[model samples]
Target: MTCTKIAYVVAGTISIFLGVLAFHVYEVYNQDDPDVFPHNLFFPLWFSMDWPSQRTYPFPDHIQYVDRQYYAEILRNPDYAQKLRDENAQYQILDRLFRLKIIRDKFGIPLTLTLDESDTFSMWVEPKYPTFHGIDVGIGKKDGRLYVLYNWHIHSVNLFEDINGMIADIGSQFDSMVCSDKPTVVDGDLVTIDLLLPSSLNDPNKVAEKCGDREYRMCVQGTYHLHNTSGSPVGVLGYTGVIDFTHLGINRGFRVKSLQLKTTENGKRVLYKLN
Candidate 1:
């Protein structure tokens, strides 16, 4: 190629490179210094945390659920020069907003639901004895009190029937607390249940024939808020008390069980009766 043509080509390439760099510099200069929250982003990004360890919350996978953590991590990632290329680093860009409806319904209405401000949507419960915690997880209530069951229990099941059976077995065989008859809540009706413990269940000295005489006593109590809908609804009740949990999984320690619940007419409402 001729010297003149070569020089012209080099000049054009250098100009194009300079223009790209100038645009980048201009963007950095004009960028707003974010304070606390961004003035550009007035929309609140909210999410419920799920802590299997109750700390070092694993950020939600959704962009909105983890926008702050994502962007902040992106900014904090510095070019590392250790042995070779950095391993624990990620590069990210903030260039989009996600918008969609949050669905927390099971089946459909007469069991359809609209989230109320007062209504419990989710929870991050830490047990009374934080140190003795089993696990913590995010729970969205589909029908009503189901959220309580899901949050409190860590058995790794989500089906309503599965949850119900787990509660029944846990109450009866483990905790000595029994669940009242099948829930009688109706659609849109808010029902509060004052569940009671079995008389001898919480006794510290209570012994079982199967235990070979290792007796431990602990109290079990729980109050569940049950709501029923025309659609089949299954919910949960959470409680805590003291007991020897040495046999926590073998039905040895304090736990929950289901009791046959009888309902009798009271004024115009039916109330639970446990025999």
Candidate 2:
């Protein structure tokens, strides 16, 4: 996938990472015994919209028009609103996602939220997609029907060519997806692609190779297209690209030009370029 702002999703355990956040939730939940609280006080796995259940989180301070309808619906629903009560029911959501969808450097994106209780109350939202975990997928509105236009995972690649990226950004990085122009490519001559990566230094466990104790690593994925000319008839020989999963992906420049194919064996002349 092409590394864009769309890929940055908030995927993390809210308890520790977001601990400094609203302490009121903690104070209310732990008024009596800390042992009663779930070790992971987030990811409301028990209740789902599917089984007439509701998962609640903090209401955003701002008056966001984008998700006003969705919030209004939840606030109006008793099942949904009940979850916010202080231990009002047998099960409560430790954490929840009100409106968060982002995609980033293909790494460390919020992926899952699970419930711990045995309540029949199952909750749900909408058309969640695969390969969407690493993206910042959130709720929004479009023509009255609610939609999701969140950003997600970060990826990067550098190449000096003028072809539409096919393999790397094959599915997600099209013109309409990024609000950018589609690139054309010429299919002759050798092209070079370079890459750089970053680490979060959060891998204190030393289990992650790229993390290396970094708080985070910016992984990336991208492609560089190349094309041929009208007079040429030779296919491409071969090429290589640097693979780095640490930094977010980027395309410096994409240019389409006419090029002639080099003779391989039978003096065949092949060229590839934009139409």
Candidate 3:
């Protein structure tokens, strides 16, 4: 072949290779924008083009649109509304479960409401139905209270050293089911409740070792009080649960496990009772 013909062939090959490379780059960046077409073969090329007209603009808050539709359907359903009301009535005893407050972190990001140390409520909200029982506190009232409009809610509490507090949170709802009106039975039979412990507590040499020898597990024991409608304590209830550290260590997160509750004398205790 002549030199001029060979040069033309080489130029054609380089152009095709460069085009393929550009398409790959565009695909990587546009993965989140599925609507962008031709995968926008030369991503940088679109920068020189007119905005919106030449490039497919990312869709407006599709999640918000879907959420609006979701709530609209809920609003239209009488049964769903009744269900929510029923849940509220069932957990009314826990209406004051936690003294919650909202504050902002250093970056001005509105931090979610967290539980304060002391509060009075003797029922537990099921983990699956937290939205039904969460206390909604709006800020910026005319009376000089601050408010924040948040899309999400806090679903879990950090126990820290408050073991009995955590027990009350998990046990009250179950107790309510057993005895809502009558003087609560402190010496009731053991009833199963949901409990989950952190994976960090799965230490065989430390936590698990104290639980059992053949089967390594971590056991938690705590006490909580039950009250009647007038806010007088009936008695102290005891809770004990075991965690399968073997499974927890492998999964590296929380999973629902069974815990049992019974009544105990104020001074006498079982399981991980604090001094």
Candidate 4:
């Protein structure tokens, strides 16, 4: 072939190579794109402590804390970051309710009690004690009597079919509490406790045996809520609660299970398992 013809062939090959390279780059960028929500869709603007300048459109402080923590996790593993973000958005309204103390005072339960982690599972019984990590509390009025609702988020634990058993066990304890009338049961995919108290709430450990074992074991996610008779949400509370089972002779257990709550200074979320 002539020199000019050879040059023409080389140019064609280079053009095709550049086009393929550009397509690959576009694909990679699309895969990692952070705008999961549609542009026109309305997502509430939340303030972040990490981004204080956005104060004009600030997320609730609790939400800020959670967002920072989850986004940090995105840096390490982008696979589940969007899932976390979607869940966080659903939790924002509830977090604000607890943060502003609306639910606490409404039910005459203190905010400290809801966020308390010292009492393990006893918070379900003793109103004065702090709430366990996975439990969220709120009050609703039905038929002119005050009713308390307990929302528990059991996550990452291996309860399997035993989850229903554990919740039923917990429900039974609530049913035994001193009440003027029978406790109303509002069972769901998640656990919801509604008890009408005649006097002060009391502790029941009837299911202590089910708290942990080789067959049934679990921990709580940090965010949960309460709903009213019409199924309207009452409030949301966020806190980390992990139950240690090593003392119970369980070889596989979570030493430190951190959910939506901040788990690291750098903002990365973590779930530490001890086996």
Candidate 5:
């Protein structure tokens, strides 16, 4: 090749090498600055490169529920973290409630449910003392009727029939408390019953402190606003009493021990304390 031709080829090659090096330097310096995209002219602004500043949240494969703890840790801000925890607690409570079975009507009008505001759905779990596991209690509306659902963990076969049988046995006691002839539904882990509203809310004689051989005592009291299906305003019940959950055996999966619900106004309601 001629020397002139060789020189020209080398010049072109050097220009290309210099151009590539300058582009690499530009990318390294400006990639982190999201604002630099608008000024660039050589390359299309849309041409993308991964930046360290960007973050991603990928969903897990096996985890069915939200990873609340992971988010809390990453959030760092105390207010947001606390909010997340509260939401998680609310979610878990709702999950348990949704799984509960309607106790009274085996087959009847499917009652739609609505809970009090998220802030109102609170719980106080008493630590298990020896054989008597503590109870879980909360109040909500089933269609137009106000009801409370409460339960404790038990050792039992995870079969539907066995759970139902346990509900029938334990529920008999629950029924006596509220004077309810309604049947019970079994949720997972514990026998969660959709309590049947008692026919006789005024019958104080029906409260059962003993079921078969087991002896127990229970009391429930709270005040909450009631709402109808249309989400209209319903009057709030203002009355308070101690929730007395005495010693109860672990056998038969204590569904509802005993519930004593009262209101200032003359409202027809039976709040049974489940043992």
Candidate 6:
């Protein structure tokens, strides 16, 4: 082959090699999974990228020495030593990180809430056929007062087959008075009446006397109320609740409507209805 032809062949080979290398690099960087790259290649890259040199804590050696001394003290305590041994392996790794201050000081982001500026409402219900039983609402001071509003529902069903109207007759009283009274104000916070629907609807003696030996599922729905004793308008900051599903089995839950506190022009606090 002529020298010029040979040079052209070599250039073609080099171009193909470069294209394959570029494709591999792109796959390593753009893939959804971080483990796309082999550990040997990934660890160096990750360490260099997140080395924390710019924000390195001073006296790391001293910190390590202190941590070792404290760990030695823990080892001297038989109970603590046994506890450490009983910990899971992953927890042990986290404990080491905490000792080194890597997972402690470096990741110590405190969450704070200013109660005076924030308001919240929450409900806790029994884990039964219907998830709601009671609720609690809190309205934070705006101008000087707080306000809250809520609603809920309750339901009961007789599971036993009705034969000769016997079971139906017994279960009929399950719908008797469940929840009553408006929300009451206590210490400037509006609180709901704690209602346990299951206890009332599923009473064994009552069910036997009224509906015979039968199964009944009960649920509750209603609105909780709040009072603003602070004399100022209130604003809600966050709302949360603990839901119980132990009795109802899986995939059953409760829903609540949005509640808010608003100030009227005359500085009166009232429940804000959503449009």
Return the top candidate by TM-score: 5
The reply for model 5, stretches above 4 Å from the true place, is 1-75, 80-86, 103-229, 232-266, 272-275
CA shift of 115, model 4, Å: 12
Predictions in order: lDDT: 0.29, 0.25, 0.31, 0.32, 0.31, 0.29
- Per-residue CA lDDT of model 4 for 79-166, tens digit only, reads 4323332343234333333443323454433222122333222111111111112333333333434344443321222323354345
What tens digits encode model 1's per-residue C-alpha lDDT throughout 36-131?
221121111122222222222121212112233333543453331110011110000000000101112322222221222332211112221111
- Candidate 5 lDDT tens digits, 54-155: 112232211111223423443554353233224432332223223334322221222223335532321221111112222333333333343444433221
TM-score, prediction 4:
0.16
The Cα error of candidate 5 at residue 158, in Å, is 32
Structural RMSD, model 5? 26.7
Q: Report clash pairs, candidate 4.
A: 46-58, 46-59, 47-58, 47-59, 94-236, 133-241
lDDT of 3 by residue, 125-169 (tens): 111111111222222222332223323222222322154334444
Report per-prediction Cα RMSD to one decimal: 26.9, 25.0, 23.9, 25.3, 26.7, 31.2
Question: Which sections of candidate 3 miss by over 4 Å?
Answer: 1-66, 71-226, 234-264, 269-275
Instruction: Write down the TM-score of every candidate.
Output: 0.19, 0.16, 0.17, 0.16, 0.21, 0.17
Report the error of model 5 at residue 22, Å: 61
Clashes of each: 17, 96, 5, 6, 11, 23
Q: Of models 1 and 2, which has the larger TM-score?
A: 1
Worst 10 residues of 6 by lDDT: 41-50
